[model samples]
Target: MEEIFENRGLGLGLSFSGLNGIVTYYDYNLDDNQQLHYSLELTGQQVGNSFKALRLTEESTDMQSISKSGSGNSLEIDRILVSGTYRWFVDESLVWGISEGLFYGAGGGFGYSTLKYQGERYKYGSQHIR
Candidate 1:
């Protein structure tokens, strides 16, 4: 048998993280020009096999992609992670912006994550900006 799980964290943006759950995080502008920001987020879920995800291999098995499923009442595997993000304004006020980030220090009993911000629309023009 197969099963899937999902959950949302209470915060300002959409985050997805899991060995079996979803989570997201966000940060907003701190200055008028909005050229600088503290934005951050997390995404994706942890599933299948932990060994393959962590690139772990035993002497008996050559290194390879890991995928597996099981029948049980526990998905006790933990896919914990932490990430950071920084954003800059293509246009000021953070109305029009671009961001880049990295996710490091993630490991076995862990999974990959991606971050994104929603609910804000970009506004254009110099003086007309807010």
Candidate 2:
């Protein structure tokens, strides 16, 4: 004899002030008895003055899973990641007076990630500027 289970999910988002964001979360179990769970978020924004505009964005994700091994043992894994960036730009027509319809910008960002499995943890991260 055998049995089965199923699951489904849906998500929605709203934004204001030239900024938008969305988040989603889901969890489900597989037929083999593995369990999975995860969440994700994303956001973006743009603000401007007469001379320049600023743009920003960010994203994050987390996930975990547990499963039974061939030896009938349970194993679990977890992971997380986060990152963001920003930029400033000026219209080429305003700086060069050529009206070629272009812009220049500089940006920077950073990111970090971590993972855990079988009583051990690992981490990674980075940063940048331009």
Candidate 3:
């Protein structure tokens, strides 16, 4: 079967007071003899230091598939995902000068995902911190 796909995206960034921010958007499309797919995504992030930062992302996808040779059955799927993250920077100094300007940190993120397929819906989520 013949298949084709295309994608487009744009991004912007800014920085101030040791804080940096970025935003991006993407669009995607696909077509095939028995399937069609489309997707969109938006992502953003802010970073102030090696030890502290934040991130956010969201995505949506749609897909349709049909059987060409068997019963002509068709199936459709739609999915969405959202996620976020936070990070902290830790700095340690030693008198022996063995460790200088070293960056270390621990952080956790949470995410959620949903799917709709064949008239059925499913949802999932998670969260954690450290």
Per-residue CA lDDT of candidate 1, range 27-78, in tens?
Answer: 4444422322222322222422333354443433212112222331221333
Off by over 4 Å in 1: 1-20, 32-76, 92-130
Flag regions of model 3 displaced more than 4 Å.
1-62, 66-69, 88-130
Candidate 2 TM-score to native: 0.22
Write the residue-wise lDDT of candidate 3 on 11-122 in tens digits: 4433322122333333222221111222223222212221132332122211222111234333432222233322222334332375443333333433333322243234
lDDT of 2 by residue, 11-61 (tens): 443322222334455545332223344445433211112112223222211
List lDDT for all candidates, in order: 0.33, 0.35, 0.30
Evaluate model 2: give its lDDT.
0.35
* lDDT score of residue 78 within candidate 1: 34
TM-score of each candidate? 0.28, 0.22, 0.22
Worst 10 residues of 3 by lDDT: 60-69
